[model samples]
Target chain A: MPARVIVVTSGKGGVGKTTSTANIAAALAKFGKKVVAVDADVGLRNLDVIMGLENRVVFNFIDVIEKTCKLSQALVKDKRVPGLYLLPAAQTRTKDAVNPQQMIELCEELKPDFDFILLDCPAGIEGGFKNAAAGADEALVVTTPEIPAVRDADRIIGMLESMGKSPIRLIINRLRPNMVQDGDMLAKDDILDVLSIDLIGVVPEDEGVIRATNNGEPMTMTLDSPAAHAYLNIAERLLGNDVPLMDLESYTSRGFFSWIKKLFKRRTRQY
Target chain B: MDFLRKLFGGGNDGSGAKAKDRLRIVLIHDRTDISPELLDSLREEIVSVLSKYMEIDNDKIEIDLDRDEKAVALVANIPVLRIKRGNVDYDKV
Candidate 1:
């Protein structure tokens, strides 16, 4: 069977589009499925660096499209996970380097070999976003719980609906539970009320994500991080498994108790 | 501070509610491509055209885009004071 080409996109930048793509692809590959993470950001390629395969990107997707390199040669295999690969985008070229038709054709060529193809789309609903979305059978729209991010996500959802994409799912990233409890940040229910899409997963704000990125390793590689568990659950849900949503309130209450214990310990030591 | 306010039941309507309200209005405009100014102008044009045939209570006129799950409708509630006498021939038949 051909691979399921799914584009991980957010209309706004810095909402973890590339990170989600890398982590989900890695998680899927870890499950023993063949997966390829395609960086379709064109001029601003970061999937290679995020996947920690930057040094191995000798050829890119553009090179394959232009017939400068074979598709297999352009694909950079991730030694960390079996059956995982990276198709880097050319940093020097502009988004106009490839059109929607070319992207569709590329996905066709990749379909037979891989079990899943995840496209890391660029920000904005311009050529780059359209090109990335053109070939996908499904979409994973990522958004943080903010006014601008949610508004832009709504616009993207409208566009995806017009394009007739099936089963558009939402991933709420960087959700701070304490803020939501304080009625400051938008809650998951509030976001769903406006976006009206299927919820795939919610990744809590985790400092470990920064460290994992700096090390060129995704959060899913380790079993300790909360964010890693969230990403793995998303992979499971994508595979048609009915995984329940992560209990964010448990994290909040646990944090509160830990803080109170630390404060009591400090006061006793001060005496 | 936030916890204290929440405990006092003072800040229940925080910025989250404000954000949701603002997004609701903005998205309606975005989806229909109709701004407040555009709606006002449309109401004015409708009032003018209706006033030529009937005496309408202009102050009570309301026009808005009503959105449901499937479609948006330009709903107008125009109050008429009286119909003009010479605008129509009641005995034309």
Candidate 2:
């Protein structure tokens, strides 16, 4: 069967588009599906770094597009996940290196070999955005629960709609539930109301994500933290699994009370 | 402003709420390729045109552009204060 081409995009920068793409692709691959994540952010390529495949990138997206290397040569096989692959973006080239038509053709080529082709789109609605979106069957727009991010997400959705992108889903990244509960941040409902897209996943603000980034390991590799669990759930949802959203309240740290409660319950059970 | 709101008894109209409201209005304009100023002028024109036919409550009149997944709609809620009776009444006709 042909692969489902999904584009991960956000009009604003630093909202974790690449991180989501890397983790989701890894999670899908972990489920035994043949998955390849294509980094479409040509100039500022970081997906390869996030996937820990940067040093191994002999050939890149531009090489495949420019017909200098075969698609297989450019795909860095992820050893950690059996069926996972990463097609690094060209760090030396610009977005103009590849056109929209070429991107569409690339997806067409990869469709037969991979089960999922996830495109990590660059920020803004420029040539990069157009090229990244040109080949997508569906879109995942990632945003934080902030005004600027949400506003940009709305713009991206509108643009995608105009371009006839089907079934665009929302992924709220770095969501601080405690802040939302304290009325310091925008709630999920507020974001959903504005964007009006189907919710795919909501990742909590976890310090582990930063650690994972530093280590060049995606959170989906280990489902220990709330963020990792969220990414894994998103992957499951992507595979057509009807999983309920993670209850962030329970997932949040209750501080010393939970520890004391656990101790108290253990002592009472001894009787 | 946020500090003031924090000091005072701010209800749902916190910074987040304000952002939501602002984004809603901005998105409407962005989708329709229209500006807020243009929408205001359009409201004024619509009110003037409607006032010639009926007694309209300008203060109560609401005009906005709303969008869904497929289409965009210009929704106007014009409150008719009173209907001006024309020269030819329905009963007489």
Candidate 3:
């Protein structure tokens, strides 16, 4: 079978769409599946940076679309993962430079050799989002456990369903288990109730994610990081394995250990 | 504001709570492509039509619109003006 084009999108901004794209792609690649991560942000490209492949980009997604370079030429092979590659978005061109038909054609051409193609979509239901979703076989609606994000996601899911897309899944990102336990935040079940879609994964709020993202390293590269393990489990589930979800509460420190973490945080200034 | 109140229980809206509420109402209407002004006009027209046909207690009348299960409805509770007063005057009959 050819690659399944999964566009990771959220209608609202700052909901970890790019991070999920990078991490999910990395996870799939690490599992020995051929995956190509495409940055579809165009003018405001961030996936390249998230994947830490910005410095090596000689060509971009626009180059492939414009025929300035072949699809093979635009793909930047990952340094650590053998089967992974990234086709980065263009920085100099606006979204109007590409069309939905071209994106569909590009994905069609790239499907044969890869097992999964993850498109990191830009926020909003604009031209760029349309182009990104045009080629997708399935959609991973990334949303935070917040009202605004969930509402926007509901709108997006409705639109996708109206467009006759099927198997649209949800990934709740940046979930704070402590807040959920304390009744200060919404949980995974609450989100699913609103969207009423199949839940694919839930990622905990991990500070290591921030540390890794700042260093332009994908959190998935850190195998033991809770977020990484959760993402890897999500990838396995995506690949037809019915892996259980991660338990973030187990990772929470208590008693003496909790006191030590607080003391350490007090000693180190937060960035 | 209602949605934030419903979701976050009014958290994260302290500084711009009013603005966020306004935006939420506006966005909900905008995305649904429905206008509150249009609804108000519809209500006014319906109430006017009701008043023209019969004597109605306008103060106590309530003509409202609602969305239930993606369905639209006009719900009215109009009080009829009594033709006779004084507890139906049973003895006078």
Candidate 4:
């Protein structure tokens, strides 16, 4: 079967688009599916660094497009996962280095070899975003619980719908369950109500994500963290499985003792 | 006061609710591509055309774009004081 080209995009920056792409690709590969995470940010390359394949990248997507290297040569296989690969973006090139037509052709060439091709799109609604989304069959729109992120997600969803992309799903990142319970932060239902897209995953704010990124390892490779479990569930959902959303309360519920502890901590700080 | 509210579990409507309310109003304008100025002009033109046949309550007129699940509607609430009677010329106001 031809690969499912899925673009991971968010209209606003710093909303975990690259992190989600690396982890989801790694999770899918762990499920025994051949996956490649392509960084389409061009000069602002990040997936390679996040995936811990930066030092190993000798050629990039631009190299492959310009005929400087074969597609196979440009792909950097993940040493940790058997079936996962990374196609790093060119650090010296700009967004204009490649166009949507080249992106479509690249995805076409990757279709026969991989089971999943995930594009890590650049932020904004300009040419970079268009190039990343051009050849995709599906899209994963990432956003946080904040208003600005949700608004941008709505705009991106409108664009993706006009582009004829099917199964556009939402991934709400950095949700603080405690804040939601306190009615301080937007809940999952609130975000879904605004975006109105089918949700594939909801990842809580996990410190382990930052640690894993800095260490150049995907959390899915260990399956030790709550966020990793969420990404795995997302991969299963993408494969047409009816995996239920993770019970986030299990990870966040610290009971009355922790709340009382926080109360005293707040009181002590007033001095 | 915030600490006391947290202790009593008596939270107000919350900032999340405010955010949702703000987004709804902003998105209505965004989705319809209609600015506030455009809506004002639209209301003026509509009231002028209607005033030729009826005594309209211009100050009380309201025009808005309302959105639901599948579609958006241009809803107008224009109160008329009375209807004008007589044969009206097509071209002459």
Error of 1 at B88 (Å): 15
- DockQ for model 3? 0.06
Chain B structural similarity as TM-score, candidate 2: 0.58
Model 4 agreement with the true structure over A1-271: per-residue lDDT tens digits: 9999999999999999999999999999999999999999999999999999989999998999999999999999998999999999999999999999999999999999999999999999999999999989999999999888988999999999999999899999999887776677889998888678899999989999999999999999998888999999999999999998888877765779987876675467434
Candidate 2, lDDT over the whole model: 0.88
What DockQ was computed for model 4?
A: 0.34
Error of 4 at B57 (Å): 22
For candidate 3, write residues B1-80 as lDDT tens digits: 65434343334323233333443454454355546797677767776776655667868877666554344556778897
Residues B1-93, candidate 2: write the lDDT tens digits: 754443333553446676667677767666677788999999889887777668988788888877774468889998888887773366855
A best-first ranking of the candidates according to their TM-score comes to: 4, 1, 2, 3
lDDT of each: 0.90, 0.88, 0.82, 0.91
Model 3 scores a TM of: 0.75
Which lDDT tens digits does candidate 3 get at residues A5-62? 9999999999999999999999999889999999999999999888888899999989
**Tens-digit per-residue lDDT, A1-271, candidate 2:** 9999999999999999999999999999989999999999998999998988888999997899889999999999999889999989999999989999999999998999999999999999999999999999899999998878988998999899999998899999998876675466788998998788999999999998888889998889876788999999999999999999999977655679965664464356334
Cα lDDT for residue A61, model 1?
95
DockQ of each candidate relative to the true complex = 0.32, 0.22, 0.06, 0.34
In order of DockQ, best first, we have: 4, 1, 2, 3
The CAPRI quality class of candidate 1 comes to acceptable
Ranking of all candidate structures by their lDDT, best first: 4, 1, 2, 3
Q: Residue B87 CA error for candidate 2 (Å)? A: 25
Model 4: clashing residue pairs?
none
C-alpha RMSD by candidate, in order: 6.1, 8.7, 9.4, 5.8
The most accurate candidate by TM-score is 4
Name the regions of candidate 3 deviating beyond 4 angstroms. Answer: A254-271, B1-93
Candidate 3 vs candidate 4: the lDDT winner is: 4
